[model samples]
Target chain A: MSDIYTNNYVIVAIFLILGVLLPVATVSFVGPLLRPKKPTREKQTTYESGNIPVGDSWVRFNVKYYIFALMFVIFDVETLFLYPWAVAYKELGLFALVEMVIFISLLIIGLIYAWRKKVLEWN
Target chain B: MNTLLQQAPSWGTTLWFIIAAVLLLAVVLGFVTYAIYFERKVIGWMQLRIGPNRVGPLGLLQTVADVAKLLLKEDVRPQHADKALFTLAPILAYAPAFAVLAVMPFSESIQFADLGIGLLYYIALSGITVLGVITAGWASNNKYSLIGGLRSAAQMISYEVPLVMSVVGIVLLTGSMNLEDIVKAQQDVWNIVPQFIGFAVFIIAAQAELNRTPFDLPEAESELVGGYHVEYSGFRFAMFMLAEYVYMFGMGALITILFLGGWLPIHPSLDFIPGIVWFILKFSLYVFLQFWIRATMPRLRVDQLMSFAWKVLLPVALFNILLTAVVVSYQNGMF
Candidate 1:
């Protein structure tokens, strides 16, 4: 509103109009211009591309993937925080070192749980 | 915050904000558009075909054409779908792509935000995309989307660990979280020369995080039939496509920044190529390499995927971090 009311008004308003109208323009301009018009059952079908799609894609997955994923998120986030500590290493020194060790150790327990559960044992 | 803003130089801050936003938006939008094209071209080359030659010259404009076609298609929402969540999921999936770029340093001084806790912000923000996928998968109430979203949640969370650990070594060496500082440390020598193992681990984990190739169990067309996004059509579906390639380029850009020197050269003599150009070239190479790997490798079994991250990548990354700490400590003492 401020930009539209100020010296930047014209420029900002052009972008504003485009933002609202562009999608509408695209649908009309491009849809009819492209996509062949001879309506066939296959032409409109969700593109299996001449191959018959068999069996619904939804099926049970190994629940074990969930466990590993859970562990990954916890650890992934922990590692990310370490970047700041690494950067501030000079100012923080050994105090930072000790703090990181404690933090990493907490994440290691999740790793241990995965190992003990034998989720790591793949042939 | 208001007082701080009033006290500071507004021009430089505004300029940085604009530049960073432009770079971030351009990369996310441009990469997402072109990734589809690159994927087709690579796949076509492997299969010995011209590949979308009808669109623009050699199909250079094929993605634009495809995006246009998608926009025109019907955006069908299942009557049973939770309207609010259904409508919101694509934006949910896509918005994080832009947010994560806040932490990614395209070149020295070129970043959206230099929050002192940059790396942590990158990791934390990326996890938000999982919720978006889960939301899409759950809202559609399609069996396939539910399973796909479930698979995405599983795959990304699993891969995020090693990806973070891969950078732990670099952080140890640079002793700074500011991505620019990390890049500056590399002017003496790129971290890749010392942290080669970390670099390799990062690339592998990034591929998995972005759901490329073997780790793409979430969207495995042959198996789950388009996974979490199966119900989406037209522009909403295009949002998922956009989020995906943007994520890919984001990881590639992160890799370039963290491991490949973020536009620093092997020698000072090659400084003629501007830093941003060097960064972009490196990123493009990584993106191409991802396509190359996709054409060559087969998808892994679900069990194989979990075990590999837990047993293999985690161990290597942990070992790398410890080793880097010791080495960096010694180097610091010497200096």
Candidate 2:
């Protein structure tokens, strides 16, 4: 059983390496060989319609995205906890169901808080 | 495949895995190639146009020729772009998209990885692609690209919560995260019957996760101007496109496994047919639905997208979990 477990991960690791290698070989190596390299000044400018781009794009912008990320982290962590309990629900019985109910209700509370606080709003 | 896994760790097993991975990669590539072709043909037919009939017969090779054109074009990099991230972004995006397939059980014997946490593995790895999108936007030094990247990131993150929650009911019912177990759990009746709400939330969130139409505000060409990959060209751009289509394939297979009973025949009498054929048929239905919806639906407003995920889908998904738990426990004689 454990052999099957370890082997499952080993295959995944191999697939990961091959995944990266396939694109790198094709996009970086095989691609550059066939593609042109002419680099005029105008060709290298940041594309923003026909107009020349003004200033840098990496400027500090919206804080709303940060709020959304915060909410996602909270919910995502809560969801992760729910997974294990879920998988073991059949063995753990009604007691586990009750516990998960409290847990998920707590999550619902957090979501409701975010909604009430307007953290989920995108203006 | 299970037999090989049951054996002790050996060089032979690893070698077989590599060969399988390579073959699966080719299969995924073939699926993507045709998916794009069919998406165009399907959408074009909807729009009253012929759509790429100039390529190979019935426009079969249109995507191939387009890929060739993209490959041979100039590999452009803006002068002020962060050279490293610009180059690395595509690999990061494409790798995880492909890597998630490691856990995808195509047919029982054809599965590559049988990770215990197969479902979670897919969701977790797929999340990494969002980083690459954000990185490409920040690295591009283009204003539109940054906004598009951030918009897509927000959209993805918003939908991800519901997407993950939507599957909790399936895990609760099957009592295992291994996708094979989930499929087997549905041997009687598919999860779609009991878990219809999950199926609905999942399919909707999945559409948003893939950044397809209705949720395609990130790449609204009318505004963001080609989204995060605005500055990418040649094979680099192709990598991003490849990642999208490959992810579509992954999502389709996942939906089939979770709701459509993986490779199970609709009825026991139909067991004479191969499991893989049923798997492909169900998988094709999903892929075709994606194209059909893309042709039919318009893009949702950005605010509408965000609010819908949080206010509507999240609560509905949470309710689904509670509902599934109640039903499953009652059936298990725990009520």
Which candidate comes out best when scored by lDDT? Answer: 2
- Ten-residue stretch with the least lDDT total in model 1 chain B: B1-10
Q: Chain A TM-score per candidate?
A: 0.55, 0.92
For every model in order, what is the iRMS? 8.3, 1.2
| Per-residue C-alpha lDDT of model 2 across residues A21-120, encoded as one tens digit per residue | 9889987789888988899999999998999888888899898999899889999999999999898888889898889889888878887887788887
- Looking at model 2, give its docking quality level: high
Residues A1-123 of candidate 1: C-alpha lDDT, one tens digit per residue: 332123122222222233233333433455456433444554333333345545433356667656556666577567757766666666665666667677777767767876997766643
lDDT of 2 by residue, B1-335 (tens): 87888988799999988998899999999999999998999899999998878887988999999999998999889999999999899998999999999998878787878888999999999999999999999999999899999999999999999999999999998999999899999999999998999999999999999999899988899988899999999888999999999999999999999999999999999989999999999999999999899999988999999999999999999999999989988999987
Could you report the DockQ of all the candidates, in the order they appear? 0.18, 0.84
The residue-level lDDT of candidate 2 at A68 comes to: 90
Number of backbone-clashing residue pairs for each candidate, in the order shown = 4, 0
Q: Which number leads on TM-score?
A: 2
Candidate 2 ranges with C-alpha deviation above 4 Å: none
